[model samples]
Target: MNHRGVEFTVAKTAIPGIWQWQFRIGEETKTGKTETKIDLLAIRRVQLRIDRELKAIGQRTGPEPESGGMVAGENA
Candidate 1:
Protein backbone atom coordinates (compact mmCIF):
# COMPACT_ATOMS: atom_id res chain seq x y z
CA MET A 1 0.00 0.00 0.00
CA ASN A 2 1.09 3.57 -0.66
CA HIS A 3 0.45 6.35 1.82
CA ARG A 4 2.05 9.46 3.29
CA GLY A 5 4.48 9.80 0.38
CA VAL A 6 5.91 6.28 0.79
CA GLU A 7 5.09 2.84 -0.49
CA PHE A 8 4.93 0.09 2.14
CA THR A 9 3.88 -3.47 2.56
CA VAL A 10 2.22 -5.48 5.31
CA ALA A 11 2.79 -9.19 5.43
CA LYS A 12 2.00 -12.02 7.74
CA THR A 13 4.88 -13.28 9.82
CA ALA A 14 5.60 -16.78 11.01
CA ILE A 15 4.20 -15.95 14.40
CA PRO A 16 0.77 -17.22 15.26
CA GLY A 17 -1.03 -13.91 14.75
CA ILE A 18 1.41 -11.15 14.01
CA TRP A 19 1.93 -8.94 10.97
CA GLN A 20 5.12 -7.26 9.78
CA TRP A 21 5.24 -3.98 7.94
CA GLN A 22 7.88 -1.65 6.54
CA PHE A 23 8.38 1.54 4.58
CA ARG A 24 11.39 3.44 3.24
CA ILE A 25 12.20 7.10 2.99
CA GLY A 26 15.29 8.77 1.64
CA GLU A 27 18.27 7.62 3.69
CA GLU A 28 15.87 6.14 6.23
CA THR A 29 13.61 3.16 6.69
CA LYS A 30 11.22 1.94 9.34
CA THR A 31 9.85 -1.49 10.18
CA GLY A 32 7.52 -2.80 12.82
CA LYS A 33 5.18 -5.58 13.83
CA THR A 34 1.51 -5.38 14.73
CA GLU A 35 -0.51 -8.00 16.57
CA THR A 36 -3.45 -7.85 14.20
CA LYS A 37 -4.41 -10.45 11.60
CA ILE A 38 -6.20 -7.90 9.44
CA ASP A 39 -4.15 -6.46 6.61
CA LEU A 40 -6.01 -3.14 6.53
CA LEU A 41 -5.48 -2.63 10.22
CA ALA A 42 -1.78 -3.19 9.81
CA ILE A 43 -1.69 -0.69 6.97
CA ARG A 44 -3.55 1.90 9.02
CA ARG A 45 -1.07 1.49 11.86
CA VAL A 46 1.80 2.17 9.53
CA GLN A 47 0.02 5.22 8.15
CA LEU A 48 -0.34 6.65 11.66
CA ARG A 49 3.34 6.07 12.27
CA ILE A 50 4.25 7.83 9.05
CA ASP A 51 2.04 10.76 10.01
CA ARG A 52 3.90 11.05 13.29
CA GLU A 53 7.24 11.08 11.50
CA LEU A 54 6.17 13.64 8.91
CA LYS A 55 4.64 15.84 11.55
CA ALA A 56 7.95 15.89 13.42
CA ILE A 57 9.65 17.58 10.44
CA GLY A 58 6.85 20.02 9.54
CA GLN A 59 6.28 18.21 6.30
CA ARG A 60 2.83 17.86 4.75
CA THR A 61 1.13 14.78 6.07
CA GLY A 62 -0.05 13.22 2.80
CA PRO A 63 1.00 11.28 -0.21
CA GLU A 64 2.04 13.13 -3.41
CA PRO A 65 3.87 16.41 -3.16
CA GLU A 66 2.13 19.76 -3.28
CA SER A 67 2.72 22.33 -6.02
CA GLY A 68 5.66 24.14 -4.41
CA GLY A 69 9.38 24.62 -4.42
CA MET A 70 10.86 21.31 -3.17
CA VAL A 71 9.86 17.97 -1.73
CA ALA A 72 10.14 16.79 1.87
CA GLY A 73 13.74 15.56 1.63
CA GLU A 74 15.78 16.94 -1.23
CA ASN A 75 18.82 19.03 -2.12
CA ALA A 76 17.81 22.65 -2.34
Candidate 2:
Protein backbone atom coordinates (compact mmCIF):
# COMPACT_ATOMS: atom_id res chain seq x y z
CA MET A 1 0.00 0.00 0.00
CA ASN A 2 1.28 3.46 -1.01
CA HIS A 3 0.30 6.61 0.77
CA ARG A 4 1.67 9.99 -0.39
CA GLY A 5 4.66 8.24 -1.94
CA VAL A 6 5.30 6.18 1.20
CA GLU A 7 4.74 2.45 0.94
CA PHE A 8 3.66 0.50 3.99
CA THR A 9 1.94 -2.64 5.21
CA VAL A 10 -0.46 -3.07 8.15
CA ALA A 11 -1.03 -6.48 9.67
CA LYS A 12 -2.70 -7.92 12.71
CA THR A 13 -0.60 -9.21 15.56
CA ALA A 14 -1.25 -12.15 17.89
CA ILE A 15 -2.62 -9.81 20.49
CA PRO A 16 -5.96 -8.13 20.07
CA GLY A 17 -6.18 -4.36 19.57
CA ILE A 18 -2.59 -4.36 18.42
CA TRP A 19 -1.69 -3.79 14.78
CA GLN A 20 1.75 -3.71 13.20
CA TRP A 21 2.67 -1.30 10.46
CA GLN A 22 5.75 -1.68 8.33
CA PHE A 23 7.12 0.80 5.83
CA ARG A 24 9.65 -0.09 3.14
CA ILE A 25 11.71 2.63 1.55
CA GLY A 26 14.58 1.61 -0.69
CA GLU A 27 16.71 -0.82 1.33
CA GLU A 28 15.42 0.42 4.68
CA THR A 29 12.40 -0.81 6.62
CA LYS A 30 10.56 0.94 9.43
CA THR A 31 8.02 -0.75 11.70
CA GLY A 32 5.65 0.34 14.41
CA LYS A 33 2.48 -0.70 16.26
CA THR A 34 -0.83 0.94 17.10
CA GLU A 35 -3.81 0.01 19.23
CA THR A 36 -6.30 1.08 16.58
CA LYS A 37 -6.95 -0.71 13.31
CA ILE A 38 -7.57 2.46 11.34
CA ASP A 39 -5.23 2.61 8.35
CA LEU A 40 -5.32 6.42 8.20
CA LEU A 41 -4.07 6.75 11.72
CA ALA A 42 -1.39 4.13 11.17
CA ILE A 43 -0.31 5.83 7.94
CA ARG A 44 -0.09 9.21 9.64
CA ARG A 45 2.06 7.79 12.40
CA VAL A 46 4.41 6.14 9.93
CA GLN A 47 4.55 9.26 7.76
CA LEU A 48 5.69 11.43 10.65
CA ARG A 49 8.38 8.94 11.63
CA ILE A 50 9.56 8.60 8.03
CA ASP A 51 9.78 12.38 7.70
CA ARG A 52 11.92 12.59 10.82
CA GLU A 53 14.21 9.83 9.59
CA LEU A 54 14.53 11.47 6.18
CA LYS A 55 15.41 14.80 7.73
CA ALA A 56 18.02 13.13 9.93
CA ILE A 57 19.63 11.57 6.84
CA GLY A 58 19.68 14.96 5.02
CA GLN A 59 16.82 13.99 2.74
CA ARG A 60 13.93 16.37 3.38
CA THR A 61 10.59 15.95 1.63
CA GLY A 62 9.51 19.35 0.36
CA PRO A 63 10.20 22.11 -2.14
CA GLU A 64 13.22 23.31 -0.13
CA PRO A 65 16.53 22.86 -1.89
CA GLU A 66 18.97 20.36 -0.47
CA SER A 67 22.06 22.51 -1.06
CA GLY A 68 23.07 26.19 -1.00
CA GLY A 69 20.72 26.92 1.85
CA MET A 70 21.28 28.39 5.30
CA VAL A 71 21.85 25.69 7.91
CA ALA A 72 20.35 25.71 11.40
CA GLY A 73 23.56 26.60 13.30
CA GLU A 74 25.37 28.84 10.80
CA ASN A 75 25.92 32.47 11.74
CA ALA A 76 24.47 34.89 9.23
Q: What RMSD value applies to candidate 2?
A: 5.7
lDDT (0 to 1) per candidate = 0.81, 0.75
Query: Could you give candidate 2's per-residue lDDT for residues 1-76 as a string of tens digits?
Result: 7765767787778987677888876688888888866757766777777777766656544565579878899999
Q: Can you give the lDDT of residue 20 in candidate 2?
A: 88
TM-score of each: 0.69, 0.56
Regions of model 2 farther than 4 Å from truth: 59-76
> How accurate locally is residue 60 in candidate 1, as Cα lDDT from 0 to 100?
51
Question: Who wins the lDDT comparison?
Answer: 1
| Shift of residue 65 alpha carbon in model 1, Å | 18
Q: Lowest-scoring 10 consecutive residues by lDDT in candidate 2?
A: 56-65
> For candidate 1, what is the TM-score?
0.69
Clash pairs, candidate 1, are: none
Clashing pairs in 2: none
